[model samples]
Target: MKFAATVRAAALCTAVALLPATTAGYAQVEARVSPEFARLFATYQRIKTSYVDQVDDEALIRGAIDGMLASLDPHSSYLDGTALQRLNTMIDGNYQGLGISVQMEDGAVKVISPFRGSPAEQAGVAAGDYITHIDGRLIYGLEIDQAVEQMRGPAGSAIELTIFRPGRDNSFDVTVTRGVIELEPVTSELIDGNIGHIMVNEFSADVGSDVRNALRDLQGQATGRLTGLVLDLRRNPGGSLDEAVALSDLFLSDGQIVSQRGRNRQDTIVYESETVYRGDVAEGLPIIVLIDEGSASASEIVAGALQDHHRALVMGERSFGKGSVQTLLPLTRDSALKLTTARYYTPSGRSVQEGGIEPDIRVPQLSDPDAERRQRLAMRESDLRGHLVNEAGVQDEALERDRLDDPRFQLTAAQLEEQGVTDFQLDYAVRTLRRTAGTVASR
Candidate 1:
């Protein structure tokens, strides 16, 4: 039907205008109708005429579009009118809902971890719990976003979830009423040895301010400056791009912070650190970034920029490879397409596409053996496959050989699979930073 072609054409223009410009360089000049989209379009047209029941053309178009977008990025998926608004509100980090974080891993919607003091956490949701059904419907093969949508309801409304936790054989159910999630992204802790820990759960619009405020509060409470900063990016499935850039620039002075490139347009868009500087004086202090498989998108942006610039040392396994930038292109009735615009690179021009930013010292999580890749071969056809963004062109080089073995360190990348205990790794980072501080003091 011409209507299908008409919808695609009109939606394409609307999508382009609503999309984000990735990382300053190249704006998306056009949206390609992915092969999957094209094939689905044809199928929808056929379904209209051959269906046993009278099929609505608009319904067919929306269904085809939804399925097509869902195939690209697991995060980028279909949200009908009300659903789209709800998704946007959650991303804004001020949603009214049963607060919980879940991920699509290995074909199940598993709980990553609950936000501290959140409704879900209060209701007894724990990590490693699998959500088998929402309400009464089985959500086994649905996309991650679909399952998430099932969990969302009006603020006071209650929803029941049947969960399968690792230690429990029988599926247990929890019915929790929704509430508002208005907490700021930056939260802190006084962890072992006067360590100032800042957990940046997500990079929202207010994150930069929240971080600056958190650091101030922590510094004031301590007798002297805190020993070190553990910038936890673990399970922080990224948020805003601007927040990532702002957070990276919060520590770096004059380094080329991060760059964006796609379609071979090199000089098209580059983002140097804005006028921000580490005027706080504790900027270069011993900083350890904790990353894991869930740290992705803008999360990878901050980690990659900080690690490559040597502004902060990364101390976990490779981050989740989700560096490509996607912007929301709105369409009729709150429907929009989250299209991939460009891939982000570090200041050194290294792209964190398929293979994410590897930690300076690999500290795979000791808590989960199945999570660690003992001989983890890195990459697949769809995943970005390399570690370096501008390996051939960068001026500074990281020369330290991989320390797969070290007596003092118990959780190097290779050992995480064999044993569990990231304590040694954390201890080494602290000791190294403390030693560095002493050296600086002596000088």
Candidate 2:
């Protein structure tokens, strides 16, 4: 009862805060509490008193909050204490677990993508694999947070996972040993022909600075001056927005990077280049940005900025369309609302809500044998239920434009492997850079 009263009071406060200062606004706010509050309270009371089992007040309240957020969008949700801690752990980039991002789809936990060089990846947990159980216990209907909690443990711990991979005949189990996951956001190396390959794992803290350092290190390692650079953003689910801006600024000297517009005009903000960093760190070097269906949010932001500014040539398949920005609004110390506040835009004012960023050069991951199958089944923002509609009304045909196979990408995974090409996308980018070294830099 105490918690219910607290919830009511919080709702009232939120309503009052959203209302204008006029008396008419106050009347409208008061009127909003009439039938809606009664219906919600009635349902809560019914569930608490007449349910088959004794339902606690916290459970009822949390369920209500979760249901409310579920109605908004897939990204907007309530973060409980455990969820908050997990988010913090991701931001800190150090955790002991199977480093894979998973989402609940139709009561089944589906793997998004395993982090690079994580135990899950080392143990061969591919994306689109549905985790059916944890340690022999069925977890088909468990909450995503609960399922993730069951997976996390101290370093050197082992956990068994039952995976149901799509396109496979039967389910299989794999044992992954947990270790300390130190996420190195920016990792660079000098490839053949003095080309710098920098793979940004995520847009975590100090990503810009880390990238600058990586570029310097790459330049130092290169036999001669660096001819070109490939910024690989494949399978990066995005992180800090500020870091995205900073990373984009490293390649652009002038012009707007990205803009975000919300319901209120006051919430509109524009980010520009040369604000975070002075000038293009890798100035006059051909830059190719590689993106795929796994790249979303901050990754899209950086890709969009560089593409719009003609600083980098965006290659690979279309990106994961996630243009909305989620703002964390704290209600309590351990609880918060991750609300979708604004829809971001590229410098050219293109919103990648439903229609993601189309690559300048469409390159498929030919090294992955299941690339075509996964592309057909990949879920983006538009696939989610209750996702916000794009204002520009993106055509459905644009989403399927890549389905038609190109003659250039005819090589099979086995063929690529036989040719000693592990990553087809990166190799293609490297070859492109080698051939067109001064071309993208002149863009």
Candidate 3:
């Protein structure tokens, strides 16, 4: 009831603020109570008084709150209890589970992506898989928290999942052995030709520091000067905003990294380089940033900044396009409103709302046989119902083209695997870097 009252008050305040300053507009706003508000209150009263089954006050309030946020956008939501705890755990960068990021879609659990090097990924679980059942129990219509809880267990425990892949003709079951999902936010290795490879799993706390350390480690492994650097952000659903800015700052000497704009003037803010770390860490080294459909939010921020600055060549598929900033407004001791406070922009003022970061080089993952089919079924921010519109006004044709198959990519996952290519994208990036190094050496 208290939550409903707060919602009503907030709605009223928003309506009043939108009213024109003219006397007629003021009179019209004050004279008639909002019909929508009245209808909502009436419905609430009817449900409370005349429902056949008794409904708890907390359930009613929470439902009301969820409905309100759901109407705003896909990313906005009500967070409390397990959901809140999970968010904290993600930012902390460790959990005991299958290490997959998921969301509820139409009452079914949808896999966003499995964490890099996790058991789920090793078992071939992929993005765009719909999880229908957990173990032997039907999990449809269950809360996301409940479904997530079912997936989590002690390390080494096994869980069976019934996955409905959009491209597949029939559903299949996958058994994964859970483990201590210790998220190594940044990892680096020296590849052939002294190329440095760094993979950023997530932008958690101290991610900038972790990346810096990774760079140092890779440099140590190299026999001579590092010829190039590959910064991998594939399957990285973003985390801390500050860490994004911090990581971007590592590649830029100066200029704006990213900017956030909200309805209120006070909410607009710009983040610049040279504010976190100093000059570019890999200065003068050809840098390639690898991203895909799973790379989102903070990942986009880093990629967008580096791409816009011409500091890095962004390769792979388009990013996940989650540019909206969610400010956690505390409601109670354990609960908060994960409200969409602002939309972020790249240095060139491009909004990443629906149109995600387009790669400088559109390299398809030739390794996966299902890549083409999955791309067609993959859900981006643009596919989400009630998603925010880009202020620049995007053409529907552009969004449609993203799913169209390119004749250039024809290799199957099995074919590539047989050729000793575990990851086509990374291999392509390394080859590209090697070629670039050759050109520089010849010059």
Against the true structure, candidate 2 reaches a TM-score of 0.91
User: TM-score of each candidate?
Assistant: 0.72, 0.91, 0.89
**Pairs that clash in candidate 1:** 25-269, 349-389, 349-390, 350-389, 350-390, 351-389, 354-383, 354-384, 355-384
Candidate that would win on lDDT: 2
Candidate 3, TM-score vs. the true structure? 0.89
Q: lDDT of all the models against the reference?
A: 0.63, 0.84, 0.82
For model 3, the superposed segments whose C-alpha errors exceed 4 Å read 1-36, 404-408, 438-443
Structure candidate 3, residue pairs in collision: 367-413
What TM-score does candidate 1 get on C-alpha atoms? 0.72
Please write out the lDDT profile of model 3 over residues 129-181, one tens digit for every residue.
98998887899999788899899999999999999887788999999999999
Candidate 1's C-alpha runs over 4 A off are 1-11, 14-46, 102-113, 121-130, 143-146, 153-179, 191-194, 264-267, 277-281, 367-436, 439-443
Judge candidate 1 against the unseen true structure and give its global Cα lDDT, from 0 to 1. Answer: 0.63
Candidate 2 lDDT over residue span 195-285, tens digit each: 9999998888899999999999999999979999999998888888889999999989999999989888987889988899998888889
What's the candidate order when arranged by decreasing TM-score?
2, 3, 1
